[model samples]
Target chain A: MASATELRRTPLTALHEDAGARLVDFAGFAMPVQYEGILEEVGRVRTVGGLFDLCHMGRVRILGERREEAAQFLVHPNISKLKFGAIRYSFFCREDGTTMDDVLVYRDTDEVFFCINAGNRDRDIAWMREVVARYDCELQDLSDDLAMIALQGRASVDALAPLCTGEPPEPVRREGATGPAALKYYSFMRGSVCGHEAMISRTGYTGEDGYELYFAADKAPEIWNALLETGKSAGLTPIGLAARDTLRLEAGMALYGHELDDTTNPVEAGLLPKMVKHTHDFSGRAALEAAIAAGPQRRLVGFTTAGKRVPRQGYTLHLPGDDGGAAIGTVCSGSPSPTLDTIIGTGYVRSELAEAGRTLAMDIRGKRQDVTLVEMPFFKRDY
Target chain B: MSNPTDLKYTASHEWARLEGDIATLGITAHAAESLSDLVYIDLPAVGDSITAGEAFGEIESVKAVSDLKSPVTGEVTQVNSGLEDNLSVINSEPFGGGWMIKVKVSGDLPADLLDAAAYDELAAADAH
Candidate 1:
């Protein structure tokens, strides 16, 4: 109705429409927010398998001899030390000690691939170009050239393994010997799935045992339908962005703008472990070192409300008391988790108040309801 | 999903049915559908006074929370206590067992209340 002149559509847009998905504008792309419902879809991903249209994410390939070096220099993590066919989750940050975006870097035999946020693709690509200019690397935007589907849950492997031709190569196990152990969570293998060459990665955002399949954009519908057909017995359902958000939130994974941003450093985001002990001059390294010396004043924590009230984003949090209660933080991601069967959210609060079991009052609309600070990753899969 | 023809509707998607001196109120089918997967509904206590067009309760779905505004000014005689155990009725049978509250009418019915046809038109327009 707003003149479909601006928003981009993914390759599976027609299929989503046919399946009666409720499409909404996400990062300038018309994407499916939900099909049947968030509760049912997300429940499917947790119990059985659920397929996701991750075509909205950006995929960039870095080529040439110094590709690994170029990719290593941009992020804070030790990407240079990553083994072949391995993926590292790293934060791309500005020089001012704040995050630009959280990205996944893949080390392949020939090229380094980056999975970046769709909304920050243009900015991240520009930043990457600036960083790689110093190294002997050729950068190319492959986002439009690729389509990604994340099949996640306990039932995912049972659904996906039948399509893939061979078993993934054995990963470096935690002993003197080695064998494939559930694909070893952050690694990938190149194999044929549904007769199409796919880079299947164990990396996932939903904190489930799953696989992310990447291939040519044109082959999306074929793979989508094939997976659905093959996975019907495993109860594989087509999931949408709304359920993705809820699943990731329940897993305590941060959304870029909500949990990490240009104004906030990673230390406050409870991601200091991700920052390797580095001497190299990476973007944000110097400012981050300085911030560490001064100590981050706030910390990210998980909070849950009593069953009736849902603490939504931007809700002001305060320490519950009578003496002009002190404001503490703001709710970043909030929703009623179908898995947990209650309201849960994550937010940043003063470092001292970030402990579990602490009581905080979350202002839901005008009422200050009781919210308890608790450990995150609210739902964990046994598998 | 259809709103009962005998019930009076408000612009905010509330439905009220007058039975002698008392009125039973609940959200319409359109409103229930919008609030899919209803998790909680905070109904007003019995004997509480309610004002027309003012929020007397709250309803929550996974996506959002909305205030439940009263359609007619009166005293709340009975709250849907059974709905506390089974909230799915709000989405499944909003016009029947999902009825939220009963109020004793203190005065004449509000003037702007719409019939079924008019309410459906308003719901359609609001969607657009």
Candidate 2:
């Protein structure tokens, strides 16, 4: 028997099993890691479309007299610059400059909706509530009431437009909105999705053109089935968490456990520039300031293998010479890049050796393989 | 999943073929089905010594990576070089063409390994 806390089921649990998905516990939810296989799903999403059930993630709404003011205090100070109907990728930080949770903040006329990681839902809400205890803002935990599904790939809009059935609300011209809009990267508008009033965000964890649909929980099964039915004709495949990891790795997206952890600072993770906003004070400002002045000692960098061997997490990355270079870094995430036809990985390296074109080697099966340092976003496709 | 009666099996899902004193080892059909697709494989050197129940090689599928444990202690005499370019043989013909390594038995093959019928019963019970 499964413990009560062992796993939580989404509304589409039966659907996932019916589709032959291999279910595994992820962030407390019994999520699918693959339907048929990871590679096929990865390639399918890159070429066509993939439907994903993202209902396990948390959602909270901040509204009241001081909503925007309160949300600014909750997120990084740059939250104020996000235009209405646009999403800002940011993190909530602790006083020591460690990330509490990375989130996507969606701005609206009167409220700010925060989409947070599922594993940290309770802690995130409690922390935000305690911090703004004196304020007039209301933090409503809407996670249980809402469901999210992602449709991603070059054929995403092609499969999704029919379900929308109406015009996108108002143009929200914020940074990164046009990129998703031109490619429809992150521009979402409230409209009908499969006959249910829904909010569509052009964002995804997969490195492809995609839209995340947010709707009422009760309607989840219908929407999911509709997507799978409609998407089949457009070559859309139902993907799982396994493909999610590989696709994101190829695109160089940072995952919570592998890339970002409490002990690691975002600055050292190569996200310092995005974390800093000179406009106003926010949480973790002082610690981040100190780290900037002192300079981060270690940094996250990308490396590609010389051959077919995939360097996995915890693989030691060494400098080419100096007797394996004294173990300068450890690989945090890695896999074979199906799109590029090579093995690639992300790891933390000494700041001095993090630059692109630097040569490094990783020990695979007790043998060193040549690798090259490159800038992030290993795969970029035009939507 | 195929459970060939001609092969001797281990609880670790490896099948061993004994010809004289040389035993050729490969994963079983059930193991291949569980692993899904094979992408990358790391084989032990031809002359490396392997102990019974010890990991001799690693194989990676798209989602997971697992080490293949040896069924018998031996000195590796030969390895299936074709598997370097054709790892899918593990999924297609795990009993024959998918044989991984050939070993010269260091001692008697590890005792208590299951026969084909016994392995089928073990696999069926595990499926629950």
Predicted candidate 2 versus true structure: per-residue lDDT over A1-383, tens digit per residue = 34323589888877888887877778888888788877778888888879988889999988787777778777774556766677877778888889888888888777888899988888999997876665777889889899988888877766776666544445553444322243234556677778898888878887787888899999999988887777878788789988888898988888877778788877888777544546767778888888878888999998887687777888888878655457889889888777887878899999888899999888765778888999888998874
Candidate 1's residue-wise lDDT over A28-91, tens digit each?
A: 8888888888889988988887899999999998998887778877877666667777888778
| lDDT (10s digit) by residue, model 2, range B1-128 | 65988778988888888888898999988888778767778888889999888898988775567888888898999999889899888888989899999999888777878899999998765541
Instruction: Enumerate the candidates' DockQ scores in order.
Output: 0.38, 0.40
Report residue A382 deviation for candidate 2 (angstroms).
2.3
Candidate 2 lDDT for residue A360: 86
Q: CA lDDT of A188 in candidate 2?
A: 61
Give candidate 2 misplaced runs (Cα > 4 Å).
A1-6, A173-184, A274-276, B45-47, B115-128
Candidate 2, pairs of clashing residues: A180-A184, A180-A185, A181-A184
lDDT of 2 at A123: 92
Chain B TM per candidate, please? 0.95, 0.93
